[model samples]
Target: MSITAATGVPVIEPASVPVLELKGIGKQFGAIRALHGVDLTVRAGEVIGLMGDNGAGKSTLVRIIAGNFPPSQGTIRFDGREVHFHRPVDSRAVGIEVVYQDLALANNLTAAANVFLGRELKRSFGPIRLLDHRAMETRALELFQELRSETRPHDLVKDMSGGQRQAVAIARTRLSNAKLVMMDEPTAAISVRQVEQVLGLIHRLKEQGIAVMLISHRMPDIFAVCDRVVVMRRGEKRADKPIAESSPEEVTALITGAKEAA
Candidate 1:
């Protein structure tokens, strides 16, 4: 059922048509099976928490969706159309952006520069083109403001804190006009205040109608923002339920393999 988001926007219902769907997805690394017969679906404006213990194949599943590699078996549907994603660019071309825990920002680059790293704006005059630093800075400032980030756009990434680094990585999605944003361990190491800000940003993203797949170990984060929770254990999906229908202890049990399936 639909509900109002934190920002007063309509939240997508769990039964809505999915923005991305994985059917019988599987992955194998020679003799090692990384994933086995997994099924998942994410709808627009929905935040899904992909939860699991270590070695549960969460990374393999996300990598497949991010187009880091081809799935060994199964089909992927994007916006209701079947698609094969063979490369990272293939995923990016379709508005799927992943922000890993590394943040992946250039240490010496300014936040604005990092935001527009490879996708910088250019101004040309008779074949004489130059990077539009001012435009990028302005755009970055606006994006940061939207996320309620206090970090300055001109500050070097090396000087930014964990939350700011995460913010910068997320801002890149805005530059790419992302439709589905997947974050891995967004609040793994950060101050409590910073975590609050980052969580707020996730809510803002939902208000903007962007689908989010949050892979965080923080149960509070999942409870705080996720509309649905999908749990994986031993390379298999154990649970997939609406957040409203499950308790924190129940999800924990599912993750720890105390519960068989959802």
Candidate 2:
């Protein structure tokens, strides 16, 4: 920890540990070996940029971590304990959340509805129970405010911009108190302004001490928000370096095989 010279205020690093650890993680679909000996660790509040070319096993590794499938070999340790996840729920049960590119939102629904889609708030009236619209709207409003987003709770998702949709999706993760969030192609095809908003939201998550794994092909987005960059090529990790020590040129080379490994 260091103190500011001018203000004499102490700066404390956020306490962190390896929230997710993958050791010798591998996968195979029949005879096709999709991943081999891939090891990774994401600590609390760390933002990792995962970049690679198409068919570079990025998706396969993410799917394995997301519990879409079990690894063919190796073990996954979450919060310092070994875990074997058979399905997505098992991962979610342990505070893992994924925000896919599609956002998986109900277009016709309000932002509040989308935020609490599967985990809706309920109100009981003696023998009757109903969806708690007022409570949900109140909570969703608070979440949007926490993210510093202008998205209104009652606004229909279809009428919202790409960035607002992202806000709602991220709010859901916050609602779940997710320890780690893996976002797949979050900034893809979004406008420049919207991209900035999404990056700001990522910063907010970091400030709140949530680990984020951002999977994207966009180099600027990675450099702008990530603390570290992990590169993969042909189903193997090629580089894992601090973002300050790795340039886009180096990452591009690692992805395309111009440079072997780092």
lDDT of 1 by residue, 128-217 (tens): 999999999999999999888887889999988888898899998998889899999999989998898888889989998999999989
- What CA root-mean-square deviation does each model show from the true structure? 5.5, 4.3
TM-score of each: 0.92, 0.94
* Tens-place lDDT digits, model 2, residues 1-262: 8898999999997655599999999888899988999999999999999999998999998888888999999999999899999999999989999999999999999999999999999989999999999999999999999999999999999999889999999999988799999999999888999999999999999999999999999999999999999999989999999999999999988998999998
Compare the candidates by TM-score and give the number of the best one: 2
Location of the lowest summed lDDT over 10 successive residues in candidate 1: 8-17
True-vs-predicted CA distance for residue 94, candidate 2, Å = 0.6
Residue 232, candidate 1: alpha-carbon lDDT: 94
lDDT of 2 at 99: 98
Q: How high a TM-score does candidate 2 get?
A: 0.94
TM-score result, candidate 1:
0.92
Q: Which runs in model 2 stand beyond 4 Å of their true positions?
A: 1-16
